[model samples]
Target: MRAVVIEQPGTVSVQDVPDPIPGPGDLVVAVRGAGICGTDIHLLDGELPYDRYPIVPGHEFYGEVVDVAGDIDRARIGRLVTVDPNMPCGACAECRRGRANLCERYEALGVTTDGAAAELVRVPAGLAYDLPADVSDVGAVLTEPLACAIHGFDGLPRRPQDRYLVYGAGTMGLMMGLLAADMTSEPVTVIEPNPSRRALAESFGMRAVSSPEEVDPDERWESVIDCTGVVEAIEDGLGRVRRGGVFQCFGVTETDAMVKLRPFDIYRNEITVIGSMAVHNSFDRAHRLAQVWGDEKLAPLVTHGYALDDYAEAIRTFRDGAGLKIAIRPGGLA
Candidate 1:
């Protein structure tokens, strides 16, 4: 099997590797579509503390089951599925409290082990969800990220009729905005520095602007979400939350990053600030949502596709912000 291997930080190459063999209770999938994520870039740059070098780096993916082992049902072979890459230690204190995303011993497929940026990858059968026949390849590929967005929403107050202000118009930002629009009657406003991204957001019926200044100065949102993972954006978003409103930190900022916020204001205004991590029990729900919106809303978010051999180009395109969602087709397009 050929895969994109990160030999170490700042070093990556496509090379032939031995095919993955499923262990007990696992299945081997023939990779169909794998989406490149910011985490992949972080892994390449040694930005993430959990990432392992000499590892394959794709987690947002869907594929066909080619083989199964142990107690897995043989009928699963040939079924198209999307996998939840996070495998928490069920006995951890956080997992016992139903917050598996914060499990003390976290093991994500792409980050901790070899992943789907190859012709074949092995995954635990329990983590795989079968996709409906009508679900498009693009929709299947987006399940993971959509699940993360859903988890992010789970952390919000979710007050009915609450206005939403989101920062950034990238893939995650756009998804967050779309979900916010569905949750409220009021238009969702997005702040994106890139004109092209702002245009894309407007095309989806959201109010898009290059900066917060473009919005009414007195405007405040009941729910403010920062998806840019940028310090400046986070600070600006905090200031735009309405008194007694909630602010969600949905972006992945630096571990040591710090921002200025008056502790007194949080208490005086009764503001709620929360953070959302990776996928929880939202993977199956995300797949169902994709099935509902795939053709109309979700699928359109995918703007580019490259062959597995073109992983380098895919990374370049992603870094350049050339498209909304970029997919790597390991088995080529079906």
Candidate 2:
């Protein structure tokens, strides 16, 4: 099996590895597609505390089941499935409170364990969600991230008519914009410094701009989300939240990063500042939403696809921000 191996911090390679064998209750998935995100970069740099070395680094992935372990349903074989990478310890204090995303012992497939950036991967059968036959590989690959975005939205105040201002028109930001547009029946404005991304955002019907100042100076958003994870964007977005609106930090910022915010204003304005970590019970709903959006919108978000051996090029393209959603087609699918 060919897999992308991060042997250590700041080190990665694409090479032949032993095919994964499913353990009891596990299933072997023949990797069809996988999406790359900032989390992969953090894992490569050893920035994530939970990431283990010599692991295959892909979590936003979907594939067909090839084999099943003992005690698993044989009917799972050949079912196209998207996995919920986060496997929280169900006995943790957070899990007991239904906050499993903040589980005391967080175990994610691509982070704490070997992931699906390979020809084959062994994942827990219970974590896999079956996809409809009509779902495109691109749609399946995005379910994980869309699930995270759904979880982010779950923490916000639900008001479809409320104006949304999102930072970073990357895949995550665009997905957030999709959320606003899908719910509000109108486009969401996006702030992205990259001209290419700004243009891409416009294609998604976003009012794209280089800076917040480009928007009307008197305008504010009922929902201001910083999907860039950059402290500058976070701070700028914090100041633009409407008096009684909510601010969401949906991006994965550096662990050591800090931003200054006025607590007095938050109290005086009755503002709600919230943070979303990862997927909770939102994976299924995300797949459903993906079907709705993918019918017309989601497929185009996948602007680039690379073969298994070109994983480095995929990373390069991702870092260069050359495309919207870059994915790895391990099976060499179109």
Candidate 3:
């Protein structure tokens, strides 16, 4: 099996590796489509808090089940499925409290373990969800990221008719805008500096602007989301929240990064600030949504695709912000 191996931070290679053998209660999947995420870049640059080198780096993926462990149902073989990569320690207090996404002992595919940037990968059967036949390959691959966006919505005070203001028009921000559009009758507004991204957001029917200044200075949103993971965006978004509104930090940022906030303003305005981590019992719902929106909406988000051997090019394309969602097809592009 050929896999993308990150020998260490700043080092990557495509090399032959042993085919994955499923452990008990696990299944081996022949990789089909895998989406490259910003976290992958972080892993490559050693920006993450922990180090898991010599590891394959892909988690947003789906594929056909090629084999199953002895304990798993044999009928699962050949089924197309999407996996939830976050593996939380079931015994953790957070898990007990139904907040497993914040598990103290966190391990996830592509982060702490070898993942789907390969011809074959092993995943726990419990984490795998059978993707509906109606879901396109692009939709199936997006289940993980959509699940994270769903979790982000779960953290919001989702009142009916609440307006949404989102920072960044990148993949995650666009998804957030899509979800926000569905949640309320109000138009969703997205702030994106890139002209192309802003145009893409407008094509999706969202109000897109180059900066907050472009929007009415007095305008405020009931739900403000910062998806850029940028300090400037986060700071700007905080000030745009309406009185008693909720602000969610949906993007990943440096662990030590700090943003200036007016504590007094927040206290007086009764604003709530929250952070959404990863998937939390949302994969199945995201998969269902993908089935509903696959060809019509979700699939269009995948603007680029690459063969497994072209992982380097995929990374470059992603870093250059050349497309919306870039997929790596380990089994070759369809």
Best by lDDT: 3
In model 1, which residue pairs have backbone atoms overlapping below 3 Å? none
Query: Model 1 over residues 1-334: C-alpha lDDT tens digits?
Result: 9999999998988999998989999999998999999989999999887646789989999999999999899999999999999999999899999999999998888888999999999999999999876667777999999999999988887877999999999889999988888888888999998988888899889999998788888899999999988999999898889999999999988889999999998999999999999898899899888777876787668989999888899999999888789999988754
Ranking by lDDT: 3, 1, 2
Q: How close is candidate 1 to the true structure, as a TM-score?
A: 0.97
Off by over 4 Å in 3: none
Candidate 3 accuracy as TM-score: 0.98
lDDT per residue for candidate 2 within 63-82, as digits (tens), equals 99999988888988989998
Report the lDDT of model 1 for residue 234: 93
Worst 10 residues of 2 by lDDT: 291-300
Give the per-residue lDDT digits (tens) of candidate 3, residues 1-334: 9999999999999999999988899999998999999889999999887777889999999999999986799999989999999999989899899899999999999988999999999999998999765558777988899999999998897888999999998889988999999989888999999998888889889999998889888999999999989998999999999999999999887888999999999999999999999899899899888877786787668999999999999999999889789999998877
List per-prediction Cα lDDT, in the order shown: 0.90, 0.88, 0.91
What is the TM-score of each predicted model, taking all chains together? Answer: 0.97, 0.96, 0.98
Report lDDT (Cα) of residue 60, candidate 3: 94
lDDT of 2: 0.88
